[model samples]
Target: MKRRQLVRGALAAGLTTPALAALSGTRQSFAQALTRPVQAEVSELEAAAERFSYGYQGQAPTEVLAELVEYFDEKIPPLLDRPQSVTARMRLCRTAGQMAGMAAIVLGDLGERTEARGWFDIAARAAAESGDQQLHAWTLARKAMVPLNYRSPREAARLAEESRQIAGTTPTAASTLAAAVAARAYALSGHTDKARDALTDADRFMERISGEQRADTWLGHCEQKHHVHLSHALTALGETRRARESQDRALALSAPTSSMTRTLLLIDAAMCVHRDGDTEQACRQAAAALTNVSAHYRTGLTHTRAMELHRAIPAEHQAEPAARALRQLLAV
Candidate 1:
């Protein structure tokens, strides 16, 4: 289907118009017909999903991610029941699930939390049917994040534990991802000891996995970004000093291309500094971050985090020149 038709279908399927508009950054034209059989490799879908994962870092349009999900959705059914395609079909389903999960993440980043939840369900079901345990675990972890970020930490922690259970003893990248989120949920809920233990588990699992693993899952290797998340959890738990240290490590370790991640970590760092009683420094840090953000990332999750920094500023400090600049920057 063409992009316009896909948008119409999404609306017809009950998605709000505003939500569709928020996600529409991809190209409008699709050269290949949906039902046509092509010699596409499973790796292509994996790669696409990986690219989509980094979309937050590089400012990919929400619409582009929507198109990717649509492409994967159309391609899955045609390849499902071919007699000799059993193995290929399984791989296809797993890839489709990963694509769906990635799209859901994008939607969440765009602040369309309700729609993101539905896509997460779609991804989890597809992954489960494919019998890909790691993918299933990843999907559950992704689902847990919806609550972790916006709703109840108790639910998020429960789902994260379930994801870890599904992951079992396997020390794959997916398991580490689950552990990291579980840590965050625990921290958010004030279970400091549990949060610390899960943080340790995440680090241990990450170390055990040699080389890059699960490049196809689109969660990417859990290294610096994992630490960045750890810092976020630490900040939530009021460990500002430790959080600042972790944030420094994450920023130092991250690739220069990961500006989005850097900006996010910077925002977290600003929060830490503000909590540490350096509101001027926090405002300066946030103002610097605003300079690097692209329009695509300016509105959703980024905006939310910026608002957090704004809120962290003391009422007395709000009129400071740096704080005034931060307010102006985030107003856009």
Candidate 2:
């Protein structure tokens, strides 16, 4: 019974918040049309954008988000509007989609759901324009994060499935992530069989990816990230033992200065521990997950996880040593 409650509660943590600024690039000046330099510019900017996503937790996410906004609303449009070679236009459009996707992530991290949604719409449109099936699926799957965190798991799962279908026989890292998320979302919605099936699908997708396949970039996915997603899904299904295995692997690969991804993995592991009845240990892990990072970086997403962890503790243990330690941080 406790396990069932824990599963539901773990899957249920979410929030709704305001979005980002408007798209401002439509009026920006350009070098007239797409050229080799324009292509190179997109490439360089994308590299920086990838690095930006991996920023340390204490880093100012607001600054990077503003930068992405600049690119999306100002820098990239000129390149997109002017005529170029068929191949060049497609390449430029893919870059635009990538930038839009990255921007949406920043907005989401900032708790700006509305802004994220708009950016995702731009990315999906860009994907269509670029004629990249992978990008289209990636956009769909990536956009699932907004609803996965802020709305219902059922809706999130639906998006994940759509992404998988569009991904077809050749799944990219992003599509693989969509499958992993589908597992978690299905578990949250009490579809045990479906959850396991989605997890299998995720594993299959993971196997096909190679080191150079653009995994975990601004528009990529990686093994460590896959493990984190797996841990969350397994934890949501009350499979603590399996969840811990994946959690340890994810933590092992995570950088010390990791951002939301690491924190989320820690919280999920702690929640799994909490479900297994080790309230003290769970509290400590959960508390440390928040404490290791600067207070300003603890967005609503992490805050909600902390609160959920606290609530999961037995009422009797709420005042216990580790629980007390965790409780104190909650007010911070």
Candidate 3:
């Protein structure tokens, strides 16, 4: 339940905000269109996308997403104008959107904001074309994170609310995700009341989710991630006590191999502890969290949060080995 699952499933790559983005490439003409990809081809694409979805959470190399971006860009153009089953075309479009979204995240982490926004725009369009409200909603929700990361919480809240409206009363993971991100955005904007209400809505929506829905899409599989976002919103709203409690719950509920998420939650918890006046304890906790995580596992968002935690510490304590070590870890 790290940042990534807020839009798709699982934690988004390391310390960065877990929002989805899209890509832009030179427009391809429909003159080379094929009827549709064969079932085997579709299956292969699905398998690859799913594999990349899970791989994004751990130490999966950025190259993995890069390759997916290239693959989808080359493959999607030929299928755009082809006469095929509605189901098949939708599947293709959805896969392409997912790839574009993943690519956007990778590009953002690599410090390419303009390219990332282009990819995010493309993903949103593809999702809309697929007529998948869940996909469209989640993609927009991910785009909201860009504004939040850029310090435009008001805009982020607006976009998140828009995504929530698009998600409607679906009671699916996507709707829950939209609500959760809205909560975070509201908290960041200092609208504590709105944030709390959004959090309540998110919790209620998650309660209604029954069987698997949209399991084949990146926006699915986020049952436990709800708490992760809730924790972040709580933190931003100055509810340190509740924020720590929520982070503990998230860590306890998360899978063991989810080292990235564990690192994120630990960092959040450490901040809460620091807010409570246990400066040394907070420093120690943060240092320990960084120690356990591999360098390859850190995300831009996670690093952002870690830096915030470091700055929160007193200047005198900043020189302490624990604090210094945490800073060094993040610098890498």
Candidate 4:
């Protein structure tokens, strides 16, 4: 069976558009065509799902989660019967876990506590099954963020501590994730010292990341542009000064390529300005951020952040008009 043929079969079997696009390169499209198959179509689908999840991480979580759920519902079940295939099952589990984590993040951002917890549970289970310690630790850290966002920093801190312990046995990427999560948890929990320390650890971990080891899962490019993650953590900590600094650093690093990243940096810069009481500058940055946001399939979290900023600016400010326009765009 040719690759296209297999893809057609998957599509006929209910694969989503993104899932089908992910399998565009395979020699044979369906699971039956594996001459020396190392993994199953479901596994490949899972990996693609993971990659997509990472790609939309900084965007609105609701949109990303919706897409993920659609893919899982349409594409995952068909591959479950092939459980004897270790490589396939492993891939599927890992992908499923990552998606669950992404979903948890979205639900948490939207203040859907019950839904967030359920997604976290799914993520934990999937991570355990896949034996991907990094994914496991990362998901746990994300789980911690729910409470932190909800203003219960104490519980967030505890979860962050647990994540840190789990990450200790993992690789640099996982460790960085743990550190970032801990930083946010500490910042929200009012442990400024611990938050700064965790941020430092996260920075150190990023310094050690190599090009070859870079993996492209759905959370942006994990290794190379870690400054964005740091900026996000700083922003969560209410250290707008540090967040702006980090955002500047990320922009400098991202320049000359990747419009998506640059737009995100602009948004972060805008948020920093907003926090600093410079409504004008903040509105300008938000307007610039919308240039990119308008062009892409924004996730729910990004939209919410934009909305929060929109609500924060005073009507008397000169930039209110622009801010209002941006908010209107986001609403669409």
Top-scoring candidate (TM-score):
2
User: Can you write out model 1's per-residue Cα lDDT over 30-144, one digit (the tens) per residue?
Assistant: 2233333433656666666666665544446577676776777676566564333566667777877888888888787777888888989989988988889988998999888
lDDT of 4: 0.68
User: Between the candidate structures 2 and 4, which one is better when assessed by lDDT?
Assistant: 2
Model 2: per-residue Cα lDDT over 174-239, one tens digit each: 668778888988988899999999999889978887775545555667878888888888998999
What is the lDDT of every predicted structure here? Answer: 0.78, 0.77, 0.74, 0.68
TM-score of 2: 0.81
Candidate 3, 1-332: lDDT as tens digits: 33323434312453334332311111122222342345557677767777766535554446666677778867678656566777887888887777777777666554456777788899989889888888788788878777765567898899898899899986987788788889999988889899999999988888887665524234564645776787888888879988877888888877776776677788888888888888778878877887777675576656666777888888888887777777787777
Runs of candidate 4 with Cα error greater than 4 angstroms are: 1-39, 50-67, 81-91, 102-116, 146-155, 169-171, 211-213, 219-225, 235-242, 252-264, 274-277, 287-292, 295-299, 306-332
TM-score of each: 0.79, 0.81, 0.79, 0.66
Candidate 3, residue 129: CA error in Å?
Answer: 1.1
The alpha-carbon RMSD values of the candidates against the true structure, listed in the order shown, are 11.9, 16.6, 15.0, 11.1
Q: What value does the lDDT take at residue 95 in candidate 4?
A: 78
RMSD of 2: 16.6
Pairs with backbone N, CA or C atoms under 3 Å apart (clashes), candidate 2: 19-115, 24-73, 25-73, 25-74, 215-221, 216-220, 216-221
lDDT of 2: 0.77
